[model samples]
Structure formats: structure tokens, C-alpha cells
Target: MTDLVIRNATVVTCDPAGTVIADGGVAVRDGRIEQVAASVELEAAAAGARRLVDGKGHILMPGLINTHCHAGDSLFRGLVEDLPLEPWLQTVWKAEGAILNPETCYLGSVLGFAELLLSGVTTVMDMFWYPEETVRAARTVGMRVSTGGIFFDPPGVTGDNLKGRIAAAERFFEMFSDAEDVFPAVLPHGAYTVAPENLKTAKQLAERHGALFSTHAAETRAEQADVTGRYGRSVIRHLDDLGLLDERTLLAHCVHLDDEEIQILARTGATAVHNPVSNLKLASGFARVPEMLAAGVRVTLGTDGAISGNDLDMWMALRLAATLHKAVTGKADAVSTAQALAMMTSAGAEALGAAGRIGSLEAGKLADMILIDVKRPHAVPMFDPVTHLVYSTARSDVRHVFLSGEQVVRDGALTRHAIGQTIEAVERLKPRIAASIA
Candidate 1:
């Protein structure tokens, strides 16, 4: 018997074919989709369903995917903004460098996960300091997470620290390896933050365990100039020279790549994650997604984090990604709604290394999806569901969210705890974080 059934859904499957079935129904059993058929067909197929949600006036689609984030930075939202990457990392965001303890990491992850779940992001790729704390927060909040411990060339974290970092990452993986909610990966911070030697070491570590290696690529003009000036090659070319761009690499930002870089990414089967809002806020140029697509590069979307984006809302980022490419290239057909959907869905799943399991509404795929309240004023007169998703919808329209067939959000509210609870947590942390500022 089916455990739950949702009927009367305007099903917008973000599949390759982009099929939209009106008055559709989905049956869930054992954390997988059992059937997707007409409401009457589903009702007749699954007798004695334990629960039924009348998904009237709702658009049911796979949950939005956030391919890159710094969960530990959410608490620092608005703490540093309107600054370049180098200056922001050096000064205003310096508090995190010193003050980010286990408690702060967990608090920030909790806060970040709360915002993400509410905004219809069911899964994320996190690069943060405290991997254990990130797992704790994702487990507590009931969201799917793929995180990697950071590797950088700081005075404190040397080549010797790689051993301990790898150990910690292994411990995290072993502890949560069987848990469906948390998946572990390794993260190399960025091109300028870590030495080339460290990047090589990180690749070896990831290869040993057959894991994904993610890093920040050319996300800003300064980074691009710094890399070229230092290495006499573009950032992507340098990575290619070092054999870093491969099937396992997930490069974040990717704002300043040329046609050669695009070809490298395409040939290497590497994934590029676009953070439009964060890039724009930091005055970073728009990603050449259209060019990248033509080059066959797999592109996905991410919110970056609250520290950079001021919100863990993927909906806003997806919209920005949909429009910014067209606006930047002066081509109306730059990024179509279908391409935007792929960026926010399957492409992100591929980045998170869960491509076959989630990111779509396939029968065998994991039951991860969101129900948008299409009854809203702005959601009315929906000519095309995919178009409405990119051009018209807001985060507030998310009515119900699920991860692995379990409801994490319902009635447009989080299911884990009360808003009052999150507010109290944030309120408490606000004063402490503010007081710690020097």
C-alpha cells in the first residue's frame, strides 16, 4: 500500500523532455516514487493509502537544488557585503576566520538550512570549516547535504593539517555514511586561497576515496587577473594544465572563462555552478552560460551563501540566472526556461554527485519535490509552468517540501521547528556574534 498520495497536482517534471501533466498524482512508498499518473488512476492503483494531500492549485516539481553554499557563513549574512572578494575575505568577513567554532558552525548551518528548506531547496553542496557541525545541522533540520572540509594555505592550516582534515572528513563520512540525509565530499577553497601543491594533494585524497573535488574557479575579475598575472594563464587553463578539471570536479562561480576555458570544461566533463546574485552583488561579471552550453559544459546554479548573497534562497538565484545571461549577452535566447530548469535541478544533482537518485520526478528517483502554491495572485494565468517557475514565481509560493519522501515543509512553513524557535536561535546568536566583533 502507498504511504502517501498527492493528487490534483500541476506536475512540472524537470526531465529531459520537460513534460507537464495537469491534474496529476504522485504516490510515495518507501521513500521512492511509486507511481505518477492521473489522480483517478493513482487512487485506483493504491488502495488504502495512509495519507492523502489534496494538491489542488499547486505545481508539483522536483525540489530546487543549490549546487554550492557556505552553510557556516549564513550567520554572517549582511556582515560583509558590497565588497570585492579579496577585501571581503580580508576584512569584513575576518570575524568568521577567527570566531567560527563548532557552535557557530552548527548555528549557521541550522540557520542556513532553515532558509534553504523554506525556499524549496531540498539539497545543497556546502564548503565550510566544520564538516561535523554541518552534518549535525543538516541532520537536525532534515535536509540533504553534501559537504567537504575546506583546504587552504593559511599559516595555521599547513600541508600537515591535510592529514588531520582528511581524518576528520573520513570520520564524518564513516559516521554518516549510511544516513540518507548527509553525504561527504572534499572541498578545495579557491584558486588563490590554496597553493597548487595543496590542490594536487586534495585531488589525490579525493581520488583515493572516489569522491568529488570541488573548488572556487574564476568568480571575479580580481581572481582572474591575479591568476593570469601569477601563472600567465587563465584560471581554467591553469587548472587544466594541472589536470584539475575532470569528471569529478565541480567548479563554483566560473564567471571569467573564455572560449578555451569553456572547451576545457566541456572536454573534461567538469561541472560549473553559477551564482548570479552573488556575482552581481560583488560586481563579478555574468557567467557565459550560453557559450558554455554551446560548448557542452554542464552548468548548475547556486546561492553561494548569505554572507555573499544575503539569503540561502535558490528561487531568487535561479531567476537571476535565467534573466542575467540574456541581459548580459544581449541575446533573448541566451538561457531558455528549459535550460534554467536543468541548472536548478538535474545539473545541480550531478554537481552534488546524486544524479541518478534525485533532481527529477522519475518513478525510481528519490521522492524529493516541492508543491508551489499556484493559487497566489502572481502565480495565476500560468501559460507555461516552466516559464512561470523562472519568470514569475517567488520563494513565498512554496507550500510543501519533501526530502526522501519525508515532509520537511508544509503549509508554506518549516516542519522541524517553529518560526519562533528559529527567530529565537538567530536572536540569541545575533547578540553574541555582534559582541564578538572587534
Candidate 2:
């Protein structure tokens, strides 16, 4: 018997073949996709369904994947404003985020996860401090996450100061490596924040465990010029020299990568996560997605942080990525709707090393999906569902979200757990908001 069934929906698998199963029904059992076919076929295939959801006039697709973010900064959503990366990091954000307690980080992760689930994001690649808090929050919310545990020396550690950070990561891995939905990774902050030697240590430890090593590289022109000035190589090349750029490395915000750097990323099979809203808001450069895609690089989408993006909205990231690619390249045929959908879905899953598990609406994959209200006004004149999702529809239109075949969101409201208390707790934190802003 199927645990739950969704009937009469336009199913977009976003599979490699770009399959769109129109007039389809989904059979889910034990938190996995059992079958996807016409309603009659689904009914016959699963004779007994504990619960069946009528998906008439709805679009069913894989849940969105937000591949990179700072879940530790949710409380500071609007604190860092009207400043570039240097000033924002040097002044407002760094000072604030660097001091977040485990409790604050937990609250922030919970809030961020809630927002992502509301916007149909089933998977997240979160890089932050106090990750045990993030893991606990993920468990509570029942959201899948790739945890990029921070491994950097404190403000001033001169020589070979990696033991403490590495120990922390090892402990994290040991604790949560067997977790059902948590994937632990080693994350060095960025080229500027972390020294070359520390990057090498992080790479070694990450490679030792075949774990994902994430970092912010080549985010701005200043960051770009400084790296090249010091090493006579691009930022990506420098990381490569440290043995950091590999299939196990996830480089976020490769906005200033040159053509050769793009080639290196493609050659190394490393993943790139483009943070368009954060880049735009911070006045950071747009990642060369057209060139990156042309070079066969696997690119995914991310919402950097609520502090930078002003909201934990992956839908905004998807729309910004599609439009930003076109606006910058001045070509209408750039970053196809299908490809954009892939980036937010299967490509992100692949980046997190969970390709066949959650990114696509396929049989045997974990049943993480969302039902879009196709009848909405902005979603009208329904020429192409992909384009509508990318260009027209807002995050508010997410009517339902599912994780592991369970209805986490129903009728545009969270149903898996009680979120009102979390929201209220965040609101109560208003007393401390002044300190962050100050």
C-alpha cells in the first residue's frame, strides 16, 4: 500500500531526459517514490493508499535545492545593509555573525529551514559556525542538509593552527556522519579569511574522509586582484595548487572566476554555487554562468544568507539566476528554462552527492517535491511551466511541499511540525536585535 498518493498533476521530473509526465499520478511509500504514471496506471500499481492527495490543476516537480547558505545569520536578516563585501564583512556582518551563540545559531537555522521549506526547498548545503545547532535544527524540521562545518583559526593564529579546527570537524563528522539527513563537510571560510596553509590542511582532512570541502572563492574584484597579485594565478588555480579544488570541493560565489578558472572547475569536476541575490545586494559580480555551463561545469543555486540576501528565499535565487544570466550576456537564449530548473533541482542534488536521491521526481528517489498552484494569475497564460516558474511565479505560490513523501507543507502552510512557537521565539528576540544593528 502506498503511504500517500498525488493524482492528476503535471509532473516534471527534471530528469536527464527532461521528461514531463503530463496527466500523471505519483505513488509514494515509505518516504520514497514508488511510481509515477497516469492516474489509472498509478491506481492499479498501488491498490491501497493510506492517503491520496488530489493534485488537479497543479504542477508537481522535485523540491528546490538551495545548495549553499549561512544558516547562522537568520536573526540578522536586515542588519547588514547598503555595504559591499569588505565593509559589510569587516563592519556589520562579521562582528555580528562571529559572535552568535549555539542557541542563536539554532534559532537561525530553524527559521532559515522553515523559510526554505515554505519556498519548496527540500535540501540545503549550509556552511556556518556552531553546526551542531544547525544539525539539531535540521533534525527537528526534518529537512535534509549538507553541513559545511567551519574549520578556520580564530582571528589571529599565526602558524600551523589547524589542529583545533580539524579536531572540531572530526568530532562533527564522527557524531553526525551516520545521521539520516545530515552530511558533514569541511568548510574553510574564504581565500581572504583563511591562510594558504590552513586551506591545505582543510583539503587534506577533507580528502582523507572523501568529504565535501566548501569555501567562498573569487567573490569580488578586490578578492580577485589580491589573489592574482600574490600567487600569479587565479583564485581557483591557487586552490588547485593547495589540492583544494576537486570533485569533493564546493566553491561558492565563483563570481570573479576567469575563463581558465572556469575550465579548471570543469576539469576538476568541482561544483559551483551561484549566489545572485547576495552578489547583487553586496555589489558582487555575477558568476559567468553562460561560460561555466558551456565548459560543462556543474553549477547550482544558493541563497548566501538572510543577512546578505535579506530573505531565505530560494525562489528568488532561481529567478535572479535566470534573469541575471540573460541581462549580463545580452542574449535571450542564455541559461535555458530547463537548465535553470535543473540547477535548482538535480544539479544541486548532484553537487551535494545525492543525485539520484532527491533532486528529480523519479521512482526510487526520495519523494521530495512541491505542488505549484498553476491557476494563479501571475502563472497565467501558461505557455511554458518552466518559464513560468523561473520568470513569473513568486515563492508565495508554493502550495505544497513534501520531504520523503511526507506532506511538510499543505495549503501553503507548514504541517509537519509546529512552527508558530519558533516564529514567536524569533519575534521575541527583538530585544537583542538592537545589539546586532548597533
Candidate 3:
């Protein structure tokens, strides 16, 4: 029997051809999309489906994917503000050290994932101290997550040594390697924080398991100078020299890259995750996204974390990804609306090696998608759905979110868990969070 059917909406399938179906919806069976066609074409399926959703006055599209985020850091939002990445990170670490445990990490992860899921993000690649807790929190909120053991030189939240980090990463693969909702990865902090040997170890572990390897790279000029002083090369060159750049590698914030570095990313097939809001807030210079896109590099989008970005809003990221470059480059057409939207959808799935499964709305892909209400004042008179999605749609317009045909978020609220309790818990922890850096 057909599991579910959604009809009577405009479907913005982020497929390679960019197919848009007016007055269309989708049918699902066994958690995968059975068909995506016009409402009239799906009338027969809707009649037999166990559940039917009317998507009137809405734009149905594949759910957004966030390629880089520190979800647990959501606990420290607005606590350590007005500092650059270097000093800001030191103070942030201080707060994390004082407060973060498995339980607290779980709470923060749930809070961050809740915000993302509600905002139409079905999957996120989060790097935090506790990978197991991250997965547990994602499951609680019924969303997909890509995370694994964290690699840091100093005693971070888990206080794990190099050996401990390796063991934990392996254990993570053992646990969730087969989980449909979990995309396991090994994430080191950054080139500046982790030693070259340690970074290579993380990459090797990821390669051995055929999982993802991600880290912060070239986010600031100071970061470039620091890495050059130590490694005798720029951050991207250093990583490339170490043979760490590849299809499975996700490099966050390639903001300080030269033209050659951009080509290097294209040649190596590594994905660059742009956290525009976090970069702007921290005063890290703008990334060469337009140039990278031109170079055939796969650039994706991310909401770094609430601590840096002040919110986990991919819509804001999408808007910035679409409009920020045009202003910076002085060319009104620097980044196209479709390109910006692809960064949050298909490009993100490609970054995680799940492009075949969850990126687009097509027959046989997972039914991980969202519906945005276009009846809003700002969304009226939509000329192009992609343009509306990139320029006009807000997180608040995400009326429904589905993951594998399950309604994880209905009416803009989480179905598996209530966010009120998470908010209240964070409220209780607010004083301690503020006092940590004081």
C-alpha cells in the first residue's frame, strides 16, 4: 500500500535539470519517494495512500542540508561576543570546558537540531565533543546527523588523548556505520589546533572506514599566517601536501584561499562548506564562493553554530549565499539563485556522499523534504520558486518537514520531542553559561 501522498503544491525538485512542477506533490512508500508529479497525476495514488497531505499555497522542496556546524556550541550563544575567531574560540572553549558533559551536550544538540529541523534542515554535519550524544539527540528530534569523534590536541570536553580519540572514532563507526540517519565522520578541530600527524591520523581513520573527514581550514588571514609559519605553506597547501584533500573531505570556511587554492579544491574534488553568517559575525573575510563555483569546486552551505552565528538558520545562509557575493564582487550576477539553493540542498548531500539518496525530490530517493507556506505576505507574487526560496523564504515559512516519509515536524513544531522543555533547560543553564566566561 502507498504509505503517504502529498498533493496540491508547487514542487521545486532540486534535481540536476531543476524540474519544477506546478500544482504537484509526491507519493511515498517504504520511506522512499514513489513519485513526484502533478496533483492531478497523483490523484489515484492519494486515493489509496494511508495518509494524504494537502500542500496548498506551499512550495515543496527537498529539505536543506547543513554541511558544517558545532551544534553543542549552541549552549554558548551570545555568551562570548565581539571577538575574532582566535580569542573568541579560547573563551568559547573555556565555557565549553566548564559546562559541557555528555548530558549537557545531549541537551544542546537537541536544542540545535530542533532549530535546524524546524527551519527545514533534515540533515546536518555537526562536530562536537560527544558524537554518541550528538547522534542520540538527532534521533530524539528525528533528523539525520553526520558526526563522529572529535580530534583536538589539548584536553577538550571529552579530555581524550590521541589514543582515546582514535578508539572513540572507531567505536562510533561500529555503532552507527550502518545507521540510515547517521553519516559518521572524523572531524578534527582545525589545522591550527591539531598537529599534522594527528590530522593525518583522523583522515586515515576516515579513509579506512570510507567515512568523511572534515575540519576548519583557512577561515581567516591570521589562520593562514599561523599555518604558514608552522608548515611553510598555506592551510590548503599544507592539507593537500598531507594528502588529506579528496571527495570524502569536507573543509569548512575556505575564506582565505588564493586563486591556486580554489583550483586545488576543484582538482581534488573536496567540498568547501561556507558559513557566511558566522564569517560575517566574526569578521572573518568573505569566501571566494563565486570563484570556487566557477572552478568546478563543490561548495556547500552551513550555519556554523549559534554561538558564532547567533542562530542555526539555513534560510539566512541561503539568502547570504545568494546575495552576499553579488555585493562583495560588485557584479549583480555573481551568484545565481539556483546555485545558492543547490549549496543547501544537492551540494550538501554530495558533500556527505549521500547525493544519490537524499539531495533531490525524485523517484527512489528518501522522502526527506519540506513545505514552505507561500501564502505569506513576503512570498506573494512569486515569479520563480527557486528565486523565492533563495531570496524571500524565511525559516518561519517552513510549515512542515518530513524525513523518510515520517512527519518529523508538523505545523512548524517537532513531532518526536517538544522544544519548550529544551528551551526551559537552556534557560536554567543560562546563568551558568554567562558566568563561565565572566
Best by TM-score: 3
Winner of 1 and 2 under lDDT? 2
Predicted candidate 1 versus true structure: per-residue lDDT over 1-438, tens digit per residue: 788888899998777778788889789988999888778888665567888888899999998888899877887788775678788877544567556778778888888988888889888888887777888788777788887666876733223376776676676667766767765677888778777887887777777767778999999889988888888988898888887878889999999888888999999999999998888888888789899988899999998988888887788888888888788789998988889889989888877678788888888889998999888789878888889999988988998998877899988777776656656777877866666555
Sorted by TM-score (best first), the order is: 3, 1, 2
- Residue pairs in candidate 1 whose N, alpha carbon or C atoms collide under 3 angstroms: none
Model 1: residues with Cα > 4 Å off, grouped in runs: 155-160, 435-438
Estimate TM-scores for all models.
Answer: 0.96, 0.95, 0.99
Each model's lDDT comes to: 0.82, 0.83, 0.95
Can you write out model 3's per-residue Cα lDDT over 1-438, one digit (the tens) per residue?
899999999999999999999899999999999999999999889989999999999999999999999898889888888999999989999999999999999999999999999999999999998899999999999899999989999988888899999999999999999999999999999999999999999999999999999999999999999999998999999999999999999999999999999999999999999999999999999999999999999999999999999999999999998899999999999999889989999999999999999989999999999999999899889999988999998999999999999999999889999889999999999999988988
Misplaced by over 4 Å in model 3 are none
How well does model 2 score by local distance difference test?
Answer: 0.83
Superposed by TM-score, candidate 3 places the C-alpha of residue 259 at a distance from the truth, in angstroms, of 0.9
lDDT of each residue in 192-222, candidate 2, tens digit only = 7788988888888777777788999899998
Off by over 4 Å in 2: 93-99, 155-161
Tally clashes: model 2: 0
Candidate 2 structure, TM-score to reference = 0.95
